[model samples]
Target: MRRSVISGLSAALVLTSAGVGGALLAPAASAAPASPALTTGVADGTYVSLKPTRMLDTRGSYLGRPLNAGEVYNLKVNGRGGVPSTGVSAVVLNMTVTAPTRAGNIVVYPKGSAVPNASSLNFVAKDTRANLVTVPVSSDGWVSIRNATGQTHVIADVQGYYVGSTTTKPAGAVDYFPDDPWRALDTRTAQDGPALAANDYLIQSVSYGANTANISALAVNVTAVNPQWTGFLNAWNGDENAIPNTSNLNFASRKTTSNMVIVPVTHGVGSDGTTPVLNFGIGNASPGTVDVIVDVVGVYATGDGLRFRSVGAPKRIVDTRTSLGATTLDAATTRTVTAPSTVTNSTTVALVTNATAVSPTAATYLTLWQTGVTRSAASNLNPAAGQTVANMAMVGLSDINQFDIYNNAGRTNVIVDVAGRMDLSPNLASGAAPSLSTRTAPKALGSRVATLR
Candidate 1:
């Protein structure tokens, strides 16, 4: 069933660069009105990676039309694209919004729930943007997305899903280990050299030092800086023969964009026989060059690690515009943002949050990490002068359930939306919650542009 409201990686120690294109205009604010905090149960589950597949495209294959302003659309997520018909708790998707008529934000949540005061991504008029989203599914395996302004076409490619612990752990179930944010690649440096040329691919090894063993996949933030032409970037496990058809992020000429990517890794014994070496690839698909930055935030490994727990619909826990986390953050300053009183569970080791940078005074970036943890060189969101943008971030939390947001330059308001959290495996629960559908639609036939991996 489809309902309507309108709403809307990778590893490696190595990096590359690309060229610049056009400037992007700031989009309108997308946050819903503040509502009283609601109590939500934890959904513990293990991670499962699937062959990336295009699940929805509004242009032709799916809805066959653009979404209107303030509309909500619910798309079936489970029992398709390699996801199981039952037992799936959440899904990992790379969602793209293209040809928007006007600037607006995209909000996504579990089907049958009230719209939450948050956004999944923000975009300008006639812009093409993409962000990775991890969302919980309703009992019948569906999630709702809303487009906050103007008509836009949406595309989603499924990368993986989380299965509840109550169900038998499927083969290849991986546990997650949240690492301190670390910058593994920065192609801007002379050593890494020249921006990435169109159609060029770079392979780099990503390691977690002592924690490298048993690592199967990596959670990294991928940013395209000053892309010279309008194009997209593809990330994968470095399999030369099988490059995925999906794009990790889309960027315009000269505009900077970032997305969270969870990519499986190809492993090898390092030069030091005892250590493991994990590597992945990034390919540029544009007419010009662009710089690429990869930041490792977490790892997926077998054996012991943490499971994910859904927090129902995303919860707006921080709004800098209000007294929430102090007014707009100034350049080079950091502020502490605490979780809501409802998410005080000691089991919360990390959170899956959508962080937005609104109306930045200058082109700048924001980095998020736990309050007491040493700040990492990684950045979560990058917004051009006066541009409003959002990106998903998986951040660890301090002992007091607090985290910090640091602005790189100029003043900008920050908004944090909690989608889910990482918790101990023992806390993982089972069973599905009932949900009602809003709109019914025909099943998706196939993508207009077929790119299945």
Candidate 2:
């Protein structure tokens, strides 16, 4: 036996095609009509909407007025409306549009005035054929409907699968919606709520530079020449070759100054040609100090300065210097202090000592539970869901004092290791990532490396 499916406007079912032959015949008088498609033509809520061929009318009128044929009519919706998206193969309408009107009926004025006429219908349809099958209607009303008959429940299925961001999601179709907030770039500037801008505590590289001098000849001068500090000043100002012929030197953390500063020193040894030191002048040059000018045309908040000394040859650190106040980090600040004498003890003890002394007196920052501290605002970097900022620190080792960094951020807490060596053990051990905040605890061996993840 074979099975075939049969559908109609009023009723449709499967009948045995098994040996039953070509087509199924209609029963008799009151049988449902045949349809070539799934949906029928009906009223459009929006400009384009799924419709049924035939409809019913519980209350029959157009805006409380009797409708007639051969008149222009329309339905209005508030927006750019499209097809009625009922995801069914067919549909049914249970409403009446108008009463039958002749070609020339009495004109019914909208403001309730009657005019002489003969047509009795509100609208007329002639060229347009009613569709009773599944059809796809373009937004512009370009429809593809063939010969169809009667009413159909499958008309709703012509909506085609559509995907959407709304609750009325249609499968396998795109949602023609507007842009969302998260989809935008950092226009207002915030990965958090509304306020948190993306910025960092930067040690402005623009304000820092090596002496603009070729620095050929140089000499140590607290007070030892025909013009002692002249050569030193010249060398710093981009003159490598000064009178004394022993002045090639590099400097860092010279002072904690906000304005132009001119410092003269015959102190620290030069690493240039011969690596010479001016061991002459005591009161003036035994210990070198860098002059400074702070806040030189840059974005700053509560300005600060720090003096760091990097050894060129991994030499033992005998002295250190700075220009910031005891608690200040200005370029003019000075620090001529002793450091570890052992090669193995590479930690610089300069900034570490200062930090230690200032620990109790320095202000502490308040950072806790700080994601969107306020409503609709951004806050400090809070770890993403299921993530944490673990093992983060900054270690400024041999790059600062002694021959190495002394301390930096701990595995648990945030700290700065002013003098610690980043290279150590020379074995199989993973290291921290590079970041500004990953300073070693002041007195550990590590570089200013940071860790992410």
Candidate 3:
């Protein structure tokens, strides 16, 4: 009856217990098999968008068995799905866990490396959850995933990858632009309509201001709230003919769940019917209706934007349990955590971090943003009482190199692990400003919609 998600690789990889909650498995006993030598240089830390593709689904033939406790699985990344076999430095994946037999944590690290004492996801028994992970790739084009407790099944869907930089920037590569995190859709609102009906699809326009032409993708967090039945949600580039067989977030009946989504963009007609706009589509695969909320944090575009720079591994920046940033964040309180000097050098403007709420005394959600701006109506992580949950966030950095985290409801400990940083592109055009546009309403896909049975 046990189930867990991980693929089979050579037995050379190893995983050992680190401790209790949030602690991940150890590194492999030896280095992973070496990859073919690359005559070109390393990655330049820019992104390349792709249509969503399913790379691993453990519930099916992939490994065909649940990943047991303390099991490490090396998944081949390069040359799989839409990713190139070489020249990849990192990848963006939406990771989901379902039917966990016991509560546990999931850690994702580059192949052959020691697992950092951090978790990419935390889930309880019989729960379904997903989180976005931007992981550095191993030299041999692979990454490892480990489960810390009872068996569970995992699913990984690739949305994009970062390429190596050479003397010349890779063609079609794009830079990142972090926004202040604004709400783009909420089906609960009257204007957007009621909760999404079962097996229906909705197309939502996301305004990129004047950056529409060059924008390749938008970084957004999508949440499903209080569904009438258990099921999942899928997002794509709004092309009616090419919906990927992937789910962005999963939820049980009456439960609220969220996941970060790097949705590719496509041009479409705006509300007025003639104005061109950028849009994406979300489809519900459940038997019941559910409310959907979307919040945009950033965008990917060519030229004059922030470039991504991945760290060797994710670094823990704040751990309230150890008083690293501060004591426990009390209910309705805000804490300003300064960025590490190493990641906040002159060129850096924002950080990509995994924010976790550890064993809160009561149900709560955490909101993160730059210190200078007002807190937007967006949350990065939402955890029930006594649950430890994590979600990836691209948080802007204020003038003083600081960002704020606000805890709602009861007191809880917070942990932030830095996966990468966004550096001001050296190619930024002189005097060009980067800003986010206002939120738009949702549009019914009508005859173009793909209904899931």
Candidate 4:
């Protein structure tokens, strides 16, 4: 069995003869599209990081808060088949920008195809209660993403996905962070007023390979106001508002946590803790955009109130509407793992599904996916297919519950053994994990329960 499309986190493979083919990375536009007209030569402080935590308004709108992990709430938007993370996926990047600085949404596919097994999510939010989620159709749909506590959440919304291929170099290896500042391509590029002017846009896409090279280290795209223009930029310093780069970002497909770095800034007396106040830094960068590479978890989706999931072995991989099946692994939605010549300590887990793989369904092959999960009803609809009939660690019971592992016997390699518990319905793409109530009637797996994989 060939590896499916790839994600960032790496895993160990125990091939049980699973056959799969996935994404083909395509080159990204060297420059930002005219519609968005990415600001070029933007100042260093011009860009802002997407907030991991957000405070919701009294009416359930996101208001930017320090959302610790346990305090998050997941509310499903689309409610397709099943949610990925217990019908409650957290929004990674949370930020509110001034008017006109709209959030962006992207429907990524493998090299060459405009349309694939894709899910659309947006970043633009109108307060925290209502957000415009990008779906396949251009007709903007609104969804809820947070609660009164200002905590981000996704619940019961399900959607499937397709993935593209990633090459170690050139094609699909670059990773981007939404929370970091938007920087000029290079310091030299920063000098061009046309490219780095206030509100001047510069759109960029780096293809981190889809495999082990899936981008782990990313440059936090931060934009600083030219010390000359610092005054013009800081005018909105009251709420920490910034020129947010709502660039679409995907989670680390594999095993890793990304660290974020920030430059020293002068917190404006007029600024809330939200916006970045211009400060002196290396090179005395007096307010122009300065780009620095930083570690990141992934991007947050703004469309239909998006959802995302993190999967890895040793660390369990959850299957939701967005989960890739072993069959119909598409180029943009799949992540693949390769067997090491000499098995080392690393063990990996690839997704394999049964319900979505059958015919009459768009999904024909199992795949490896990386984009944020979907949180919409149109995405997940089927009850049986969406339910987690068998959890990941199912050793042997039903063909549908079996995991096709790669066996490199004689080689001291780590093999992933997943428990085959009953998921109300499993789909990884939505990555909206299943909730207890969502799986009210668990499937009868005949007594034995699967365990740690």
TM-score of each: 0.82, 0.14, 0.86, 0.21
For residues 215-309, what per-residue lDDT tens digits would candidate 3 score against the true structure?
A: 77888899888889999998888887887888888888887777888898898766677655787888899989999998887777764456778
Angstrom error of the Cα, residue 325, model 3: value is 1.9
Which has the greatest TM-score?
Answer: 3
TM-score of 2: 0.14
Model 4's TM-score against the true structure: 0.21
Off by over 4 Å in 3: 1-43, 167-171, 271-273, 429-449
Q: Where does model 1 exceed 4 Å of error?
A: 1-44, 208-213, 269-275, 427-453
What is the C-alpha local distance difference test score of candidate 3?
A: 0.75
* lDDT agreement of model 1 with the native: 0.72
Error of 4 at 25 (Å): 43
lDDT of 4: 0.20
Task: Give the candidate order by descending TM-score.
Answer: 3, 1, 4, 2
